[model samples]
Structures are given as C-alpha cells and as structure tokens.
Target: MKKQRVVAFVPIKLNSQRLPMKNILPLGEYSLSWYIFDSLLKVKDIDDVYVFCSDEEIKKHIPSQVKFLKRDRYLDGDLVKGQEIYQSFIESVDSDIYILSHTTSPFLAANTIEKALSKMLLEDYDSALSVQKKQTFAWFEEKPLNYELNNIPRTQDITPVFIETSGFFMFRKNIFEGYRRRIGFKPFLQEVDDVEAIDIDTKEDYEFAIQVYEQVKQRAYINN
Candidate 1:
C-alpha cells in the first residue's frame, strides 16, 4: 500500500471586517499567519503546507518552504464563510488527509498537531477537532443550557462543555466528499489548554493573546 499524503491546510484572506488586515498584523515576533505557519513547519507528519489564501502579499511573511493555493475569486471577500472556502478547497485539492490550521488561532503547537494526527489515524477517526473544556454556567435565551435551575451544580461539579476553538482540525481528504463538510461523523474532541485555545477575532482578543503568550513563554508547554 502507498503511504498516505497529509496536507496542512491554512485559510487566510487579506481583508477582515472586525480587525482590518489582521492576518498580516504583527503578533509577538511574527505576523498572525506566520505564527500558524511557523508551528506547522515544525510538524514532521505533514508532507506539505499549503496556504489557501486570496492575498498574494502573504507570501512575504510566511516561510519560503511553505506553498500557496489561491482561493476562489468569489470566496476572496469577507462575506464568505470560512467553511465555504474550506469545502471549495477540498473539492479542488487532492490528498489522503488534511490538517486544517487557522491563522486566527496562533497558539496551536506543532507537537499538538502531531499527536492529533497519530491518534486520528491509529483510532481510525473520521475527524479530529481541537476543543477547550469550558467549565462555566452557560445559558441559551433565558434557560440554562448545561444545568437545571433548581438543581444548580457547582461550577466545578458542572460538566464542562467543549467549544470548537478553531484551533485545528484533522480529517481524511475524502471525509468531506460524502459529508460536504470538514468535520465528519465520529469526530474526536482533542482537548487542548485554555491559553492555547485562544482565538483572535477582535482587537481585545488579540491583546489578550499577546499577554497570554508573554506570560507563558517561560514554561514552554508544548513539545520541547
């Protein structure tokens, strides 16, 4: 049997509604997208790293070893959803498996991805997605989502719910062929650290992540 090809897919666009030019914005010692690229480069499991992007300028920031994939012209704008572009990319590319990375979530470490890939393949999971266990009171509308009104459990006692942090995702390339989505059935919820799960969406989020990174660097939590 032939060895399966795994691609590290990164989706980036030049424009941003919330924070303009956020992808190219500086984070720590590198741009936002560059952080994600840097992490992916350290992973040995990935055979290729392709940036699914609309901006040609992004090439200047990412490492030379990384490759690029021009996104569809229609999906180039801010109005299009990230999932739509990913689905479109899935249709255009050919690979055995894809590891989706987001520039918005720069804290994902290479070793974290390597472990997820190993478990995903070994367990034969259809999909693997990074999640953070949020142990807090959650409500939808007026009603509590995770706890009863009268039988309120302590925050610690309450079952923590995993939020799809968009940290990273892994799936066989063909998994989306039938499902028309990136996350397929029988998905694995790979729990990651709270700080590592930080996603950059707004200016506040960006600032918070910066503080988190500065404070936590000495620990060097990921693969050493």
Candidate 2:
C-alpha cells in the first residue's frame, strides 16, 4: 500500500481585532505561529507545511524552511472565512490529504495530529475533527429541565456533544475538490481536553494560554 501524501495548511491574518498580530506575538522564545508550524513539521507523515498569511511583516518572523502562501488583499479582511483560505491552499497543493490547523493552537502536539490522521486513514473516514466533549450541565432559555447533581453521570449518558476545537482537521483533497466547505460526510471525531486545545482569540486568551503552556512544559520536564 502507498503512503498518503499529507500537507499541513495554517491560515493567519495580520489585522486581528481581538488580539493584534496574535500569530506573530511572542509565546515563549518564538512566535506562536512558529511553534504550531514547527510542531506540524516534526510530524513524520506530514510531507509539506505551508503558512498562509497576508502581512509581509509576519512572514519575516517565520523560518525560511517553511513555505509561504501570500494572501490577496480581498481575502485579508477579518470577516473572510478561514475555509476560503483553506480551499485556496488545497487548490495550490497536490496531495492525498490536507491537514488544516490554526496558528493560535500553540499547544497542539505532534502525536495528537498523527493519531488523528492515522485514525482518519485507517477508518476510511471522509474527515476527522478535533473536538472537546462538554461535561457540565448546559442549558438555554433559563430552564432546569435536565438536572444532575455532583455525582452526575458522564456527558455521554445525558446529552453528549462535542465542541469544535478549531485546532486541527484532517481530510482528503477530493472532499473539498468541489465543495466550498471543509466538513464532509462520514466524519470522525478526535476527542481532546480543553487545555491542550486552547485557541487564542483575545488578550485574556493569550495570557491564559501562556499559563497553560508553562504548566505543560514544567510537567513534561518533571516526567522526562
């Protein structure tokens, strides 16, 4: 059997309302985008990794080893959907699978991405998405319909729902060949905890992520 050709696509914009230049902002020693890019690059199965950005200043900070996809002015707005950028990337690259990842997800591990990709291929699923399972009692319209105490059953026992982490997505190129969206039929789920799947959208989010990263790094050091 032939090995699958996988390309990792990361989309970033210069003008961010929530957090200005969040991608280029320093997380630890390197820019947050670089961490995510480097992590994906370390994955053995991923053949190519491309960073799509609009600002040339942001490109200057990225390593030369990584490839770049310049975004047109029309697609540089905050309102522009990320899916559009992803579709354009798919058209530019020739690969069996495309792995879409966000630069904000700095804590995304290489092992997790590889596992998700492996599961998607082995199970013959059309796509795989990273999701976080909600455990707390969720409600709407101020109603206490489904009440559960401290010893409540697992979320699956009540109403199991997965929130999209927007961290990573693995899918075949053919799935997005004709469609405008990234999702497809026969999609598989890769369950991830909230901490590892943190996405930086605001200044508060960035600070919180820093704390998470420090804790994770310290724990890893101790374990190793």
Candidate 3:
C-alpha cells in the first residue's frame, strides 16, 4: 500500500471586513497568524504545511519549513465564496488528504488535530471537524429546538448540540473534488473544549483570546 499524502494549508487574506488586518494582530511576541502555522507544523501526520495567501508579505511571517502558495487576489474579494477559493487551492495542490484550518482559531490544539486525523484514517471516516458541544436551550423560528417550552429541562439534561468551529477540517481529496465541500456525508464531529474552540473574528473576540492565551501561559509557567 502506498503512503497517503497529507497536506495542510491555511488561507490568509490581508484584508478583512471585521477587525481590519486581524490576522496579523499581535497576540504576544508573535502575531495572531503565527499560532496556527506553528501548531500545524507540529503535527507529525501532516506531510507538508502551506500558507495559501494572495500577498507576498505573509511569506516573511511563516516558518521556513512551511511553503508559501500565492493565490490570486481575485479570490480575496468579498463576493467570492469560500468554496470557489477552496476549489482553486485543491486544484493547485494535489494530496490524498487535505486539512483546512483558519488562523482565527489560534488555540486549536495539535492533539485535537491528531485525534481527528486518526479517527478519519483509522475508522474510514470521510471527514473529521472540530465542533463545540452546546448543552443549552436552543430555539429556531421562535420554536424550541432542543427542549419543549412545557417541560423546561436542565441545561445539563438537554441534548447537546454540536456546532462546527473554524478550528480545522480534515477530509479526503475525493470528498472535496466530488462534493465541493469540506464536510462529507459521514463526518466525525470532534468535540473541543472552550479553550480550544476560541475563534477570533471581531475586536472583542480577539481581546478575549489574548486574555485567555495569557492566562494559559501563566498557568503553564506555574506548572513548570
């Protein structure tokens, strides 16, 4: 059996609608964009890591081991859908398995990624994605979805809802090529904790993430 090629890429655009140039926002010694790039490179299963960006400036920030794939700026437009950008990337880089990750999810742990990758490869799952388990009362169209209004159950007792996070998505090449989706028919929902689920999108989100990151680092320092 031939060894399956696993490639991971983080698509970064210089411009952002919310929190302008949010990707390059300073987290600590390194910028916000550095965390995910550092994390992906640590994953042993991943053959190669690439930063798919439209600007050449991003090349300076990424690690030397990580290859830079310059994408067309046209894809960075607000009108352009993510699927179109995804299709463009997959076409450029051929791999047996591809990992789609975002810089916004800086706290997405490598162990979580490894576990998801293991599940996908071992269990013959089409794809694996990070999700947050919400066990609270949920409603849709002003109607209760998880619980009934008549019998208000405890949040703990309620059926947990799995919400997808921008943490990561591991899928086979065929899944994307065939369906044009990161998720397949059979997807393994890898539940991640609150800390690991931090996805920075807005100004508030970024601030919160910095606070959490600092706390985590302090805890680690104390432990060591």
Candidate 4:
C-alpha cells in the first residue's frame, strides 16, 4: 500500500471582535499563534504545516517550517461560517488526511497529535478529534442533562461526558469531501487533559492561558 499524504492547517485572521489582535498578542517569548505552529511542525506524521490566512504579514511571525496559504478576504468576515473557510482551504490543499487546528489551542502538544494519527491508522478510524472528559453534573435548558434530579449520584459514579475541544480535528480527505464535515461516520474520541484543551476565545480565556503557560514553563524549568 502506498503511503498517504498527511497535512495540517490552522486558519488565522488579523482582526478579532472579542479579543483585538489576539493571534499576534504577546505570549511568553513569541506571539500567541507561535505555540500551535510549533506543535504542528513537531508532528512526525504530518507532511506539511500551513497557516491559512488572508493577511501577508503573518508570515513574519510563523516559523519557517510552516508554510503560508493565502486565503480570500471575504472568508475572514465575522458573519462567515467556519465551514466555508474549511471548505475553501480543503479545496486548495490536496492531502489524504487533513488536521484542522486553531492557534487558540496553544498548549496542544505534538505527542497528542501523533497519538490521534496513530489511532486512526492502526484502528481503522475514519476521523479523530481531541476532546475533554468531564464527570461533573451538567445541565442544559434548565434541565439536568447528565444526571437525574431524583437520584443524584456521586460525580465519580456519573458517566463521563466528552466535550469536543477546538484543539484539533483529524479526518480523512474523503470524509470532508463526501459529508462536508470534519467528523466521519466512525470517529475516535481522543480525550485530553483540561490544560491541553484550553481554547482562547475571550479576554478571560486569554488571561487564563497566559497563567497556564507560565506555570507550564516553571514546571519545565524545575524538571530540567
């Protein structure tokens, strides 16, 4: 059997409504987007890493290992759906397997990405997604979603809920082309720790990520 081509892409935009210039904002020694780009480059199975953005200035901050794919400005609109951006990029890039990731998920490690790929390759899974497992009581629409009101069970006894994290989505090219979705019929839910699943969306999220990053750095220093 021929070896399949695997590629990863992260969509980026210069402007943000919630957090202004969040991608370019300072985080540790590099910009906020630097960590994810670095993580993707370290993935052994990924053939190439791309930063899909409409702006040309992003090229300066991104690592040389990552390529820049210029996208249409219209796709950067706040009203534009993520699917539209995803579809446009998938059409432009040809690969057997695609890893769709985001810059906000800076703490997502390279080993986790390799594990997701290994699960798909070894287990014959059609798709793989990074998720966060939670065992706490969850409620939705003013009703108990995970637990019953009549019989309240301990958190440990309750079934664990897996939340689809924005860290990464790995899928076969055929899945996207056929279903027009990132997930396939058979998806391997790769559960990650809370720290790894941190996605920076708002101001609070960004601040929390910075603290997490500092603590992570301190731990690494102590270990070294």
The runs of at least 3 residues in candidate 4 whose Cα sits more than 4 Å from the true structure, single-residue gaps closed, are none
Question: Candidate 4, residues 6-81: lDDT per residue as tens digits?
Answer: 9999999988889999898888999988989899899888899999999988887779889999999998899999
- What is residue 51's positional error in candidate 3, in angstroms? 0.4
Residue 5 CA error for candidate 3 (Å)? 1.2
Put down candidate 2 lDDT per residue, 79-186, tens digits, no spaces. Answer: 878777776777777898888998888888888888888877677888888899875577657753355555566656776657899789888888888675467787
What does candidate 3's lDDT look like per residue over 52-139, in tens digits? Answer: 9999888766677889999999999989988988888999999999999999999988888989998877788999899999999888
- Residues 1-224, model 1: lDDT tens digits: 57778888888877778988888888778888888888888888788998988777999978888998888678977578767888877777778888888888888877888888887767778889999888999987998889998998988899778889888888887777776677888788888887678899999998888888776775665534
Q: Global lDDT for candidate 1?
A: 0.83
Worst lDDT run of 10 residues, candidate 4, spans 56-65
- TM-score (all chains, Cα) for each model: 0.90, 0.87, 0.96, 0.96
Error of 3 at 49 (Å): 0.7
**What are the clashing pairs of model 4?**
none
- Candidate 4 yields a Cα-based lDDT of 0.92
Alpha-carbon runs more than 4 Å astray in model 3: none
